[model samples]
Target: MQRNRSKRYRAAAQQVDRAKAYSLPEAVSTLKKFPPTKFDQTVTVSFRLGVDPKQSDQMVRGTCPLPHGSGKQVRVLVFAEGESAQAAREAGAEF
Candidate 1:
């Protein structure tokens, strides 16, 4: 199925050649060419490996260092009542 992309995404996509694999420096320079955004943006890089994950020898592994840390929202679920509940709320847990 064809997916609709925004004008900003379309313009950025056009800068890279999909048919060719870009080197580290090539990728960095291409991204540097883009205009800066008003707010902080996160960059996610994913590698496509040809190895089979089922095989013990070929374990899918890699870590992308997010300098700004993971944009993960953490939620706490407390199953307590009375004083315990009050303490949890004080510790930043949403009731």
Candidate 2:
């Protein structure tokens, strides 16, 4: 049973590869046939900071890039004050 399943999976993968090579347009159109139901989906992501505090003057902060660009919009929040906040605003940050 396991061997049969493996054979079927390999055959399917090969068919996909052949389709990608021969009928690239059909393959892409078929993929785009399925429309996502939800447009705005919020996902939480985390990252680890491995910077040495003694060696580095500036500490690493904030969230990193998400896989597949999060498939959502991003809103940047800045808590800087005075000149720093003005600089951030000039740099095109929302807040």
Which prediction has the highest TM-score against the true structure? Answer: 1
Deviating ranges (above 4 Å) for candidate 1 = 1-10, 62-95
lDDT of 1 by residue, 1-95 (tens): 99998787888888889898887788889989876767788687766779899999999777988777787878888888999999999898885
Task: Quote each prediction's TM-score.
Answer: 0.49, 0.31
Please report the TM-score between candidate 1 and the true structure: 0.49
Instruction: Name the best candidate (by lDDT).
Output: 1
Model 1 global lDDT (CA atoms, 0 to 1): 0.84
lDDT for each candidate structure: 0.84, 0.61
